[model samples]
Target: MLYQPDTYKIEQDLSRFGRTGNDTFIPGATEEGLRQYRRLLRNNINNTMVQAFPISRQVLPDDEWNELINLFFANHDAKTTQIWKLPAEFVTFVKEKDYATLWGKPWLNDLLYFEWIEIEVYTMPDIEAEPFTLQGDIRNGTIVVNLEYRLIPLRYPVHLYAVEEAKNHPGDYFMMVYRHPETREVLFADLSALDTFTFENIAHEQLSLSDIAAGLKLQFALSDQHPLLINMIAFVQEMMAQKLFLGYAVERKEQF
Candidate 1:
Protein backbone atom coordinates (compact mmCIF):
# COMPACT_ATOMS: atom_id res chain seq x y z
CA MET A 1 0.00 0.00 0.00
CA LEU A 2 1.21 3.49 -0.84
CA TYR A 3 1.68 6.01 1.98
CA GLN A 4 -0.67 9.01 1.77
CA PRO A 5 -0.64 12.07 4.01
CA ASP A 6 -3.86 13.32 5.57
CA THR A 7 -5.59 15.96 3.40
CA TYR A 8 -6.52 18.16 6.36
CA LYS A 9 -2.94 18.11 7.65
CA ILE A 10 -1.69 19.02 4.18
CA GLU A 11 -4.08 21.97 4.12
CA GLN A 12 -2.86 23.20 7.49
CA ASP A 13 0.75 22.82 6.40
CA LEU A 14 0.10 24.79 3.26
CA SER A 15 -1.27 27.66 5.31
CA ARG A 16 1.76 27.40 7.58
CA PHE A 17 4.01 27.55 4.53
CA GLY A 18 2.56 30.92 3.55
CA ARG A 19 3.18 32.30 7.01
CA THR A 20 6.45 30.64 8.00
CA GLY A 21 8.08 29.81 4.64
CA ASN A 22 8.29 26.18 5.75
CA ASP A 23 7.65 23.49 3.10
CA THR A 24 8.84 20.32 4.79
CA PHE A 25 5.39 18.70 4.94
CA ILE A 26 4.71 18.50 1.21
CA PRO A 27 6.11 15.42 -0.53
CA GLY A 28 7.77 17.01 -3.60
CA ALA A 29 7.67 20.76 -2.89
CA THR A 30 11.01 22.59 -3.14
CA GLU A 31 12.13 25.12 -0.52
CA GLU A 32 12.82 27.72 -3.22
CA GLY A 33 9.36 27.35 -4.71
CA LEU A 34 7.72 27.66 -1.26
CA ARG A 35 9.83 30.72 -0.52
CA GLN A 36 8.69 32.35 -3.75
CA TYR A 37 5.06 31.54 -2.96
CA ARG A 38 5.35 33.00 0.51
CA ARG A 39 6.99 36.15 -0.85
CA LEU A 40 4.26 36.62 -3.42
CA LEU A 41 1.48 36.24 -0.86
CA ARG A 42 3.14 38.63 1.56
CA ASN A 43 3.72 41.15 -1.22
CA ASN A 44 0.04 41.08 -2.19
CA ILE A 45 -1.00 41.69 1.40
CA ASN A 46 1.56 44.49 1.72
CA ASN A 47 0.27 46.19 -1.41
CA THR A 48 -3.30 46.01 -0.22
CA MET A 49 -2.40 47.50 3.13
CA VAL A 50 -0.42 50.23 1.42
CA GLN A 51 -3.31 51.15 -0.86
CA ALA A 52 -5.85 51.14 1.96
CA PHE A 53 -3.78 53.06 4.47
CA PRO A 54 -1.62 55.54 2.63
CA ILE A 55 -1.61 57.83 5.62
CA SER A 56 -0.41 55.15 8.04
CA ARG A 57 2.26 54.05 5.59
CA GLN A 58 3.55 57.63 5.32
CA VAL A 59 3.54 58.13 9.08
CA LEU A 60 5.41 54.99 10.09
CA PRO A 61 9.08 54.54 9.32
CA ASP A 62 9.83 51.98 6.62
CA ASP A 63 11.40 49.52 9.01
CA GLU A 64 8.58 49.76 11.54
CA TRP A 65 5.87 49.49 8.92
CA ASN A 66 7.51 46.53 7.28
CA GLU A 67 7.91 44.82 10.62
CA LEU A 68 4.31 45.50 11.52
CA ILE A 69 3.01 44.00 8.28
CA ASN A 70 5.26 41.00 8.69
CA LEU A 71 3.97 40.46 12.20
CA PHE A 72 0.39 40.75 11.03
CA PHE A 73 0.95 38.27 8.23
CA ALA A 74 2.54 35.71 10.52
CA ASN A 75 0.40 36.13 13.61
CA HIS A 76 -3.10 36.97 12.45
CA ASP A 77 -5.49 34.49 10.83
CA ALA A 78 -7.60 36.77 8.70
CA LYS A 79 -11.30 35.90 8.50
CA THR A 80 -12.08 37.80 5.31
CA THR A 81 -11.59 36.21 1.91
CA GLN A 82 -11.59 39.51 0.03
CA ILE A 83 -8.14 41.11 -0.12
CA TRP A 84 -9.65 44.60 0.07
CA LYS A 85 -10.92 43.86 3.57
CA LEU A 86 -7.51 42.81 4.88
CA PRO A 87 -6.79 46.34 6.07
CA ALA A 88 -9.82 46.24 8.32
CA GLU A 89 -8.40 43.16 9.97
CA PHE A 90 -5.05 44.88 10.20
CA VAL A 91 -6.67 47.73 12.11
CA THR A 92 -8.20 45.28 14.53
CA PHE A 93 -4.89 43.49 14.89
CA VAL A 94 -3.14 46.76 15.69
CA LYS A 95 -5.67 47.63 18.34
CA GLU A 96 -5.55 44.15 19.87
CA LYS A 97 -1.77 44.12 19.98
CA ASP A 98 -1.54 47.67 21.30
CA TYR A 99 0.89 48.54 18.52
CA ALA A 100 0.30 52.22 19.11
CA THR A 101 1.57 52.07 22.65
CA LEU A 102 4.44 49.85 21.66
CA TRP A 103 5.45 52.30 18.94
CA GLY A 104 4.85 55.42 21.06
CA LYS A 105 2.23 56.73 18.64
CA PRO A 106 -0.84 57.46 20.68
CA TRP A 107 -2.73 58.81 17.67
CA LEU A 108 -2.09 55.76 15.53
CA ASN A 109 -5.49 54.14 16.06
CA ASP A 110 -7.39 57.33 15.21
CA LEU A 111 -5.24 57.84 12.12
CA LEU A 112 -5.88 54.31 10.95
CA TYR A 113 -9.60 54.65 11.63
CA PHE A 114 -9.81 57.98 9.83
CA GLU A 115 -8.15 56.52 6.76
CA TRP A 116 -10.24 53.34 6.88
CA ILE A 117 -13.52 55.29 6.95
CA GLU A 118 -12.83 56.81 3.55
CA ILE A 119 -12.35 53.38 2.04
CA GLU A 120 -15.42 52.04 3.85
CA VAL A 121 -17.67 54.86 2.66
CA TYR A 122 -16.39 54.48 -0.87
CA THR A 123 -17.05 50.76 -0.98
CA MET A 124 -20.21 50.48 1.09
CA PRO A 125 -23.31 48.95 -0.53
CA ASP A 126 -25.83 51.39 -1.98
CA ILE A 127 -28.73 52.47 0.21
CA GLU A 128 -32.22 53.24 -1.09
CA ALA A 129 -33.34 56.72 -0.06
CA GLU A 130 -36.93 57.36 1.00
CA PRO A 131 -39.27 59.71 -0.88
CA PHE A 132 -38.15 63.28 -0.38
CA THR A 133 -38.89 66.76 -1.70
CA LEU A 134 -36.21 69.17 -2.81
CA GLN A 135 -38.53 72.14 -2.31
CA GLY A 136 -40.37 72.21 1.03
CA ASP A 137 -40.49 74.04 4.31
CA ILE A 138 -37.53 72.33 6.03
CA ARG A 139 -38.58 73.70 9.42
CA ASN A 140 -42.06 72.18 9.16
CA GLY A 141 -41.12 68.98 7.29
CA THR A 142 -38.99 66.08 8.42
CA ILE A 143 -35.53 66.88 7.04
CA VAL A 144 -33.96 64.01 5.12
CA VAL A 145 -30.23 63.34 5.10
CA ASN A 146 -27.98 61.10 3.03
CA LEU A 147 -28.48 57.51 4.16
CA GLU A 148 -24.94 56.43 3.42
CA TYR A 149 -23.07 58.22 6.12
CA ARG A 150 -21.05 57.60 9.30
CA LEU A 151 -20.24 59.67 12.35
CA ILE A 152 -16.98 58.87 14.13
CA PRO A 153 -15.77 60.37 17.36
CA LEU A 154 -12.03 60.24 17.87
CA ARG A 155 -9.76 61.19 20.70
CA TYR A 156 -7.36 62.95 18.34
CA PRO A 157 -8.04 65.57 15.67
CA VAL A 158 -6.45 63.44 12.99
CA HIS A 159 -8.85 64.75 10.34
CA LEU A 160 -7.65 68.32 10.83
CA TYR A 161 -3.99 67.92 11.86
CA ALA A 162 -0.98 65.80 11.00
CA VAL A 163 -0.22 62.77 13.18
CA GLU A 164 2.50 64.54 15.13
CA GLU A 165 0.41 67.63 15.65
CA ALA A 166 -2.64 65.53 16.44
CA LYS A 167 -0.84 63.88 19.34
CA ASN A 168 -0.39 67.22 21.03
CA HIS A 169 -3.99 68.33 20.50
CA PRO A 170 -5.77 65.25 21.74
CA GLY A 171 -9.36 65.95 22.65
CA ASP A 172 -12.90 65.15 21.53
CA TYR A 173 -13.04 65.28 17.72
CA PHE A 174 -16.16 64.47 15.75
CA MET A 175 -16.01 63.65 12.04
CA MET A 176 -18.89 63.30 9.62
CA VAL A 177 -18.05 61.00 6.71
CA TYR A 178 -20.53 60.70 3.86
CA ARG A 179 -20.81 59.93 0.19
CA HIS A 180 -22.10 62.58 -2.16
CA PRO A 181 -25.24 61.41 -3.97
CA GLU A 182 -24.37 62.75 -7.42
CA THR A 183 -20.59 62.51 -7.29
CA ARG A 184 -20.47 59.23 -5.31
CA GLU A 185 -17.30 60.51 -3.74
CA VAL A 186 -16.47 60.01 -0.06
CA LEU A 187 -16.24 63.36 1.73
CA PHE A 188 -15.50 64.41 5.31
CA ALA A 189 -16.64 67.32 7.43
CA ASP A 190 -15.40 68.38 10.86
CA LEU A 191 -18.06 69.04 13.49
CA SER A 192 -18.20 70.80 16.79
CA ALA A 193 -19.50 69.02 19.89
CA LEU A 194 -22.82 70.81 19.50
CA ASP A 195 -22.96 70.10 15.78
CA THR A 196 -22.26 66.43 16.37
CA PHE A 197 -25.07 66.18 18.88
CA THR A 198 -27.49 68.00 16.59
CA PHE A 199 -26.54 65.93 13.53
CA GLU A 200 -26.94 62.71 15.48
CA ASN A 201 -30.43 63.73 16.49
CA ILE A 202 -31.34 64.65 12.94
CA ALA A 203 -30.04 61.41 11.51
CA HIS A 204 -31.63 59.11 14.05
CA GLU A 205 -34.89 60.88 14.91
CA GLN A 206 -37.80 62.22 12.89
CA LEU A 207 -37.22 65.73 14.10
CA SER A 208 -38.29 68.81 12.24
CA LEU A 209 -36.44 72.11 12.65
CA SER A 210 -38.93 73.29 15.27
CA ASP A 211 -38.48 70.08 17.25
CA ILE A 212 -34.70 70.44 17.13
CA ALA A 213 -34.85 74.09 18.14
CA ALA A 214 -37.21 73.29 20.99
CA GLY A 215 -34.95 70.49 22.21
CA LEU A 216 -31.92 72.77 22.07
CA LYS A 217 -33.71 75.46 23.97
CA LEU A 218 -34.69 73.05 26.72
CA GLN A 219 -31.25 71.49 26.90
CA PHE A 220 -29.20 74.70 26.81
CA ALA A 221 -31.55 77.02 28.73
CA LEU A 222 -31.80 79.40 25.79
CA SER A 223 -34.53 82.07 26.14
CA ASP A 224 -34.64 82.98 22.46
CA GLN A 225 -35.54 80.60 19.60
CA HIS A 226 -35.60 82.87 16.54
CA PRO A 227 -31.83 83.25 16.16
CA LEU A 228 -31.26 79.56 16.81
CA LEU A 229 -33.87 78.57 14.24
CA ILE A 230 -32.40 80.98 11.70
CA ASN A 231 -28.90 79.60 12.17
CA MET A 232 -30.13 76.01 11.95
CA ILE A 233 -32.13 76.73 8.76
CA ALA A 234 -29.05 78.29 7.21
CA PHE A 235 -27.01 75.27 8.21
CA VAL A 236 -29.56 72.91 6.66
CA GLN A 237 -29.51 74.94 3.45
CA GLU A 238 -25.73 74.66 3.29
CA MET A 239 -25.94 70.91 3.85
CA MET A 240 -28.55 70.63 1.08
CA ALA A 241 -26.20 72.45 -1.29
CA GLN A 242 -23.52 69.86 -0.49
CA LYS A 243 -25.93 67.00 -1.26
CA LEU A 244 -25.65 65.78 2.32
CA PHE A 245 -29.20 66.89 3.04
CA LEU A 246 -31.62 65.25 0.59
CA GLY A 247 -34.28 67.88 1.19
CA TYR A 248 -37.23 66.84 3.46
CA ALA A 249 -39.01 63.52 3.76
CA VAL A 250 -42.26 63.56 1.81
CA GLU A 251 -45.41 62.98 3.80
CA ARG A 252 -47.78 60.49 2.19
CA LYS A 253 -51.47 61.33 2.20
CA GLU A 254 -53.91 58.82 3.70
CA GLN A 255 -55.97 56.71 1.29
CA PHE A 256 -59.77 57.07 1.37
Candidate 2:
Protein backbone atom coordinates (compact mmCIF):
# COMPACT_ATOMS: atom_id res chain seq x y z
CA MET A 1 0.00 0.00 0.00
CA LEU A 2 1.25 3.49 -0.91
CA TYR A 3 1.42 5.63 2.23
CA GLN A 4 -0.27 9.04 2.04
CA PRO A 5 0.77 11.82 4.43
CA ASP A 6 -1.64 14.58 5.56
CA THR A 7 -1.30 17.64 3.34
CA TYR A 8 -1.11 20.02 6.31
CA LYS A 9 1.47 17.81 8.03
CA ILE A 10 3.59 17.88 4.87
CA GLU A 11 3.49 21.68 4.81
CA GLN A 12 4.53 21.90 8.49
CA ASP A 13 7.37 19.46 7.92
CA LEU A 14 8.62 21.39 4.88
CA SER A 15 8.58 24.63 6.85
CA ARG A 16 10.57 23.02 9.63
CA PHE A 17 13.09 21.74 7.09
CA GLY A 18 13.59 25.24 5.73
CA ARG A 19 14.05 26.67 9.20
CA THR A 20 16.09 23.96 10.92
CA GLY A 21 17.37 21.72 8.10
CA ASN A 22 15.43 18.81 9.60
CA ASP A 23 14.64 15.68 7.60
CA THR A 24 11.26 15.38 5.86
CA PHE A 25 9.86 11.83 6.24
CA ILE A 26 7.43 11.76 3.34
CA PRO A 27 7.06 8.50 1.45
CA GLY A 28 9.61 7.83 -1.38
CA ALA A 29 11.85 10.62 -0.01
CA THR A 30 15.38 9.31 0.51
CA GLU A 31 17.63 10.66 3.31
CA GLU A 32 20.00 12.11 0.67
CA GLY A 33 17.09 13.74 -1.17
CA LEU A 34 15.81 15.37 2.04
CA ARG A 35 19.33 16.65 2.84
CA GLN A 36 19.65 18.22 -0.59
CA TYR A 37 16.25 19.89 -0.29
CA ARG A 38 17.12 21.27 3.14
CA ARG A 39 20.47 22.54 1.85
CA LEU A 40 18.80 24.31 -1.06
CA LEU A 41 16.20 25.96 1.15
CA ARG A 42 18.79 27.12 3.67
CA ASN A 43 21.09 28.44 0.96
CA ASN A 44 18.32 30.48 -0.62
CA ILE A 45 17.56 32.19 2.68
CA ASN A 46 21.27 32.67 3.43
CA ASN A 47 21.88 34.30 0.08
CA THR A 48 18.91 36.61 0.44
CA MET A 49 19.97 37.73 3.91
CA VAL A 50 23.57 38.34 2.80
CA GLN A 51 22.39 40.50 -0.10
CA ALA A 52 20.05 42.40 2.18
CA PHE A 53 22.59 43.09 4.93
CA PRO A 54 26.04 43.19 3.42
CA ILE A 55 27.39 45.66 5.94
CA SER A 56 26.23 43.67 8.91
CA ARG A 57 27.78 40.57 7.42
CA GLN A 58 31.08 42.38 7.13
CA VAL A 59 30.94 43.55 10.74
CA LEU A 60 29.98 40.31 12.47
CA PRO A 61 32.22 37.25 12.65
CA ASP A 62 31.22 34.09 10.82
CA ASP A 63 30.06 32.23 13.90
CA GLU A 64 28.13 35.17 15.28
CA TRP A 65 26.50 35.90 11.94
CA ASN A 66 25.53 32.27 11.47
CA GLU A 67 24.10 32.05 14.98
CA LEU A 68 22.19 35.30 14.64
CA ILE A 69 20.62 34.39 11.32
CA ASN A 70 19.91 30.82 12.39
CA LEU A 71 18.13 32.10 15.48
CA PHE A 72 16.03 34.45 13.38
CA PHE A 73 15.26 31.75 10.84
CA ALA A 74 14.14 29.32 13.52
CA ASN A 75 12.24 31.81 15.64
CA HIS A 76 10.68 34.64 13.61
CA ASP A 77 7.49 34.02 11.66
CA ALA A 78 7.98 36.29 8.67
CA LYS A 79 4.88 38.26 7.69
CA THR A 80 5.89 39.61 4.30
CA THR A 81 5.20 37.38 1.32
CA GLN A 82 7.75 39.24 -0.77
CA ILE A 83 11.28 37.85 -0.48
CA TRP A 84 12.90 41.29 -0.80
CA LYS A 85 10.89 42.45 2.19
CA LEU A 86 12.07 39.59 4.39
CA PRO A 87 15.07 41.64 5.56
CA ALA A 88 12.70 44.09 7.23
CA GLU A 89 11.46 41.39 9.56
CA PHE A 90 15.08 40.59 10.40
CA VAL A 91 15.57 44.15 11.55
CA THR A 92 12.48 43.98 13.73
CA PHE A 93 13.65 40.67 15.15
CA VAL A 94 17.04 42.11 16.08
CA LYS A 95 15.48 45.05 17.84
CA GLU A 96 12.86 42.99 19.65
CA LYS A 97 15.39 40.46 20.90
CA ASP A 98 17.89 43.17 21.83
CA TYR A 99 20.53 41.37 19.78
CA ALA A 100 22.68 44.48 19.95
CA THR A 101 23.24 43.86 23.64
CA LEU A 102 23.70 40.15 23.12
CA TRP A 103 26.33 40.73 20.47
CA GLY A 104 27.96 43.62 22.34
CA LYS A 105 27.40 45.85 19.37
CA PRO A 106 25.54 48.86 20.61
CA TRP A 107 25.16 50.37 17.13
CA LEU A 108 23.89 47.17 15.51
CA ASN A 109 20.25 48.18 15.42
CA ASP A 110 20.95 51.58 13.87
CA LEU A 111 23.25 50.09 11.25
CA LEU A 112 20.67 47.43 10.37
CA TYR A 113 17.93 50.05 10.11
CA PHE A 114 20.11 52.35 8.04
CA GLU A 115 20.98 49.63 5.58
CA TRP A 116 17.43 48.21 5.44
CA ILE A 117 15.94 51.61 4.71
CA GLU A 118 18.03 51.94 1.56
CA ILE A 119 16.56 48.65 0.35
CA GLU A 120 13.07 49.83 1.31
CA VAL A 121 13.34 53.15 -0.53
CA TYR A 122 14.81 51.51 -3.60
CA THR A 123 12.10 48.85 -3.77
CA MET A 124 9.12 50.96 -2.69
CA PRO A 125 6.26 51.41 -5.18
CA ASP A 126 6.31 54.54 -7.29
CA ILE A 127 4.23 57.44 -6.05
CA GLU A 128 2.43 59.75 -8.49
CA ALA A 129 3.23 63.39 -7.82
CA GLU A 130 0.55 66.06 -7.73
CA PRO A 131 0.31 68.87 -10.29
CA PHE A 132 3.19 71.28 -9.86
CA THR A 133 5.17 73.86 -11.85
CA LEU A 134 8.87 73.60 -12.44
CA GLN A 135 9.30 77.35 -12.72
CA GLY A 136 7.43 79.11 -9.93
CA ASP A 137 8.04 81.46 -7.01
CA ILE A 138 9.04 78.91 -4.37
CA ARG A 139 8.92 81.53 -1.63
CA ASN A 140 5.14 81.93 -1.93
CA GLY A 141 4.03 78.70 -3.68
CA THR A 142 3.48 75.45 -1.87
CA ILE A 143 6.43 73.08 -2.13
CA VAL A 144 6.14 69.55 -3.53
CA VAL A 145 8.61 67.11 -2.03
CA ASN A 146 9.24 63.70 -3.57
CA LEU A 147 6.72 61.23 -2.17
CA GLU A 148 9.19 58.31 -2.28
CA TYR A 149 11.31 59.33 0.65
CA ARG A 150 12.03 58.51 4.27
CA LEU A 151 13.25 60.52 7.26
CA ILE A 152 14.92 58.53 10.03
CA PRO A 153 16.61 59.32 13.31
CA LEU A 154 19.59 57.34 14.56
CA ARG A 155 21.63 57.25 17.71
CA TYR A 156 24.81 56.58 15.75
CA PRO A 157 26.09 58.09 12.49
CA VAL A 158 26.21 54.70 10.82
CA HIS A 159 25.51 56.12 7.38
CA LEU A 160 28.34 58.63 7.63
CA TYR A 161 30.98 56.57 9.45
CA ALA A 162 32.21 53.00 9.54
CA VAL A 163 30.55 50.69 12.06
CA GLU A 164 33.55 50.59 14.41
CA GLU A 165 34.11 54.35 14.30
CA ALA A 166 30.41 55.18 14.48
CA LYS A 167 30.10 53.45 17.86
CA ASN A 168 32.51 55.94 19.41
CA HIS A 169 30.33 58.89 18.49
CA PRO A 170 26.87 58.25 19.85
CA GLY A 171 24.48 61.11 19.36
CA ASP A 172 21.29 62.05 17.57
CA TYR A 173 21.67 61.73 13.81
CA PHE A 174 19.04 62.45 11.17
CA MET A 175 19.10 61.21 7.59
CA MET A 176 17.03 61.61 4.45
CA VAL A 177 16.72 58.69 2.04
CA TYR A 178 15.10 59.23 -1.34
CA ARG A 179 15.03 57.62 -4.74
CA HIS A 180 16.49 59.57 -7.64
CA PRO A 181 13.72 60.51 -10.01
CA GLU A 182 15.50 59.60 -13.23
CA THR A 183 17.93 56.88 -12.19
CA ARG A 184 15.71 55.23 -9.58
CA GLU A 185 18.78 54.84 -7.36
CA VAL A 186 18.55 55.34 -3.62
CA LEU A 187 20.61 58.16 -2.10
CA PHE A 188 21.28 59.36 1.40
CA ALA A 189 21.63 62.88 2.77
CA ASP A 190 22.87 63.72 6.25
CA LEU A 191 20.72 66.27 7.99
CA SER A 192 21.45 68.86 10.62
CA ALA A 193 18.97 69.74 13.34
CA LEU A 194 17.56 72.65 11.35
CA ASP A 195 17.59 70.74 8.06
CA THR A 196 15.73 67.82 9.65
CA PHE A 197 13.07 70.21 10.92
CA THR A 198 12.68 71.89 7.53
CA PHE A 199 12.44 68.59 5.61
CA GLU A 200 9.93 67.11 8.04
CA ASN A 201 7.58 70.09 7.77
CA ILE A 202 7.85 70.26 3.99
CA ALA A 203 7.09 66.55 3.66
CA HIS A 204 4.03 66.67 5.94
CA GLU A 205 2.43 70.06 5.29
CA GLN A 206 1.55 71.97 2.14
CA LEU A 207 3.80 74.84 3.08
CA SER A 208 5.68 77.41 1.01
CA LEU A 209 9.26 78.58 1.49
CA SER A 210 8.07 81.67 3.34
CA ASP A 211 5.89 79.60 5.66
CA ILE A 212 8.79 77.26 6.30
CA ALA A 213 11.05 80.19 7.12
CA ALA A 214 8.52 81.56 9.56
CA GLY A 215 8.23 78.20 11.29
CA LEU A 216 11.99 77.86 11.36
CA LYS A 217 12.35 81.29 12.92
CA LEU A 218 9.94 80.41 15.73
CA GLN A 219 11.45 76.96 16.25
CA PHE A 220 15.07 78.09 16.23
CA ALA A 221 14.41 81.46 17.91
CA LEU A 222 15.80 83.58 15.14
CA SER A 223 15.02 87.32 15.03
CA ASP A 224 16.34 87.90 11.52
CA GLN A 225 14.11 86.57 8.72
CA HIS A 226 15.98 88.07 5.80
CA PRO A 227 18.99 85.77 5.88
CA LEU A 228 16.80 82.77 6.81
CA LEU A 229 14.50 83.29 3.83
CA ILE A 230 17.45 83.72 1.52
CA ASN A 231 18.98 80.47 2.79
CA MET A 232 15.68 78.63 2.58
CA ILE A 233 15.23 79.65 -1.04
CA ALA A 234 18.70 78.41 -1.89
CA PHE A 235 18.03 75.13 -0.11
CA VAL A 236 14.79 74.60 -2.05
CA GLN A 237 16.56 75.33 -5.31
CA GLU A 238 19.24 72.77 -4.50
CA MET A 239 16.64 70.17 -3.53
CA MET A 240 14.81 70.76 -6.82
CA ALA A 241 18.02 70.22 -8.74
CA GLN A 242 18.51 66.92 -6.95
CA LYS A 243 14.92 65.87 -7.84
CA LEU A 244 14.12 65.69 -4.15
CA PHE A 245 11.71 68.58 -4.65
CA LEU A 246 9.40 67.96 -7.62
CA GLY A 247 8.62 71.71 -7.81
CA TYR A 248 6.17 74.25 -6.44
CA ALA A 249 2.57 73.05 -6.10
CA VAL A 250 0.05 74.56 -8.55
CA GLU A 251 -3.73 74.77 -8.32
CA ARG A 252 -5.46 72.24 -10.59
CA LYS A 253 -8.09 73.87 -12.78
CA GLU A 254 -11.53 72.24 -12.33
CA GLN A 255 -13.45 71.24 -15.43
CA PHE A 256 -17.25 71.10 -15.33
TM-score of every candidate relative to the true structure: 0.92, 0.89
Candidate 1, residues 1-256, lDDT tens digits: the string is 2446577667678778888664456767777877888899889989999999999999899999998898999899989988898888899899889998998999999988888889999889999788898888878788788988888999989888898999999899889899998899998888777667667777888688888889889988999877888877877788788877898888899999
Residue 38 in candidate 1, Cα distance off native in Å: 0.8
Residue 121: error of model 1 in Å?
0.6
lDDT against the true structure, each candidate: 0.85, 0.85
Candidate 1 Cα lDDT to native? 0.85
Model 2 whole-model lDDT (C-alpha atoms): 0.85
lDDT per residue for candidate 2 within 43-158, as digits (tens), equals: 77778889999999999999988988788888888788887899999999999999899878999999999989999999899998787889788788888888999989999899
